[model samples]
Target: MSVKKTKVHLISGFLGTGKTTALKSLMAQKDPNEKWVIIVNEFGEIGIDGAVLSDNGIPVAEIAGGCLCCTAGPQLGNTVQKMLRDAKPDRLMIEASGLAHAASVIDELKVKPLSEELEIAAVFTVVDPRQFVSPDYAQQALYKDQIGVCDVLVASKTDLCTPEVMAEFHEQAAKLFPPKAKVVEVQNARLDIQWLDIPVIEKPRYRLKAEVLPDNTMGFQSEGFTFPAGQDFDGERLTHFFNDLPKMTEGLVRAKGVFQVLGTWVWLNWVDGQWGANQVSWRRDSRFELIAKSFDADLIEQKLKEALE
Candidate 1:
């Protein structure tokens, strides 16, 4: 008898491109009868994405501290093996770190024993249109590799983009050598669940250039902080702090945190100059993490402390 293989889907995107939001959207639409599991990888040691996703009441395995494409590859494989033997879910979803080389992750998954038990259903890459058209982001080697490795190209945060930006996104996407199976726009990372079933089209695999090192060596640094449950932040001051983060710190690219603010809990997200805080039911200890080109961690911690209630 042929062994039953579990279907797996990989979601990849650059820093702050809304991969977690997209994963949440997909999870919300999952089949009630089917058991599903999520594996989230983060560049920060604190594993904020895993914490946020766990709130949905699903079992989440987190691989933190490095990119799964390189340094964390062994851990990722082990996690998959353990999940398969224990949870035995009907489907599996992996949210690759924003800075990950997705092509390498895919290659890892297709190897030997793991490949025999897992079938890659589809690969999705989320893109922020504003960044997609920007020369700075477009020129990045990892950014281009993420796009090249996916079956579906997702344009997230479309609601915040201008018409010109959207047009340019289409123009650039059209220029990709091997066209994507589908290119769709989404608002707030609300991807259509049906897209997950899109058939995978075989394409030339993307290989990383030798000179490209792991994320830690790529000039990016990350810092994470956790506060005890009773701690609360001054909402007004916290908002101001996030709003002025780019000016207050150099090379800050992405920052996210869940904090007890005023009398309730709120989740704050800041990416490339856009940010918002929304009330949430999360009751865990407050935590914050930021990824940057470089920053004074001591000073950032001091500023955060000053915003406490």
Candidate 2:
């Protein structure tokens, strides 16, 4: 009997570590004819990564509101089955929530139905180099667990860090990471496509496991709004509104959406205290998704309505 196999790349990182950016880079290097499927698990209810990849015409499956390793495990299994049955993808990549522990995901994939079909290529964990030098890096168990589970260590956002910091990061990486893992550094999360083909030996699973909804994700939440067609947002007004959102909404972390602006469409993203808007293809509905620790959704909706009016 012949067994069917699909290569799997599990990408893990914390919030704002640039897993999506890495996916974009990797996708650009893909052969046009090859089919790749992405399963994005997000901690917040509003899924931003899925939207971004979908915009680029990539097939994406999103699991939102909690970590796939915990709350969305069943959904992950179901999604995998559907993707294999319908999409018949050449490869599969899972972008785990920043707050998740990859060991659970790996163990999940190892079990029947998925295990019989999947050939895990490598486990890649992206890290911000700046975090290596921070005292909090050692203190945060989630971060430690994320790193401990990966077969490949990816240092992302290297372009923004200093040479001294990079050197220090390498020093720390040598000591803390699994001896067999390969380390690579990238700016803007742009990793080499060849790295995906490098086969890896699976590490032992983590013994300590948390419930599907981990404590770290308790403070995170999301809200979304949809505007009907032709009820376009004013571009200038929208920019100002997003700029003022962090100040107006307590615990505001990120806000993003594709909006019909002045008869055209644009993608707006407010993240990590900065905002950017770029022109994108048209979508039927103009919608916004917000992620925050705890914010008043009514106030946000009212403020946006006022801006449009």
Q: What lDDT does candidate 2 reach at residue 128?
A: 92
| Candidate 2: tens digits of C-alpha lDDT, residues 222-275 | 666767645768777887888888877767765777677776657788878988
- Note the clash tally of each candidate: 0, 1
Could you report the Cα RMSD, in angstroms, for every candidate shown?
Answer: 18.0, 18.4
* TM of each candidate vs. truth: 0.64, 0.63
Q: What is the lDDT of candidate 2?
A: 0.76
Model 1, C-alpha of 183: deviation from truth (Å): 0.3
TM-score for predicted model 2 compared with the true structure: 0.63
For model 2, name the residue pairs that clash: 70-212
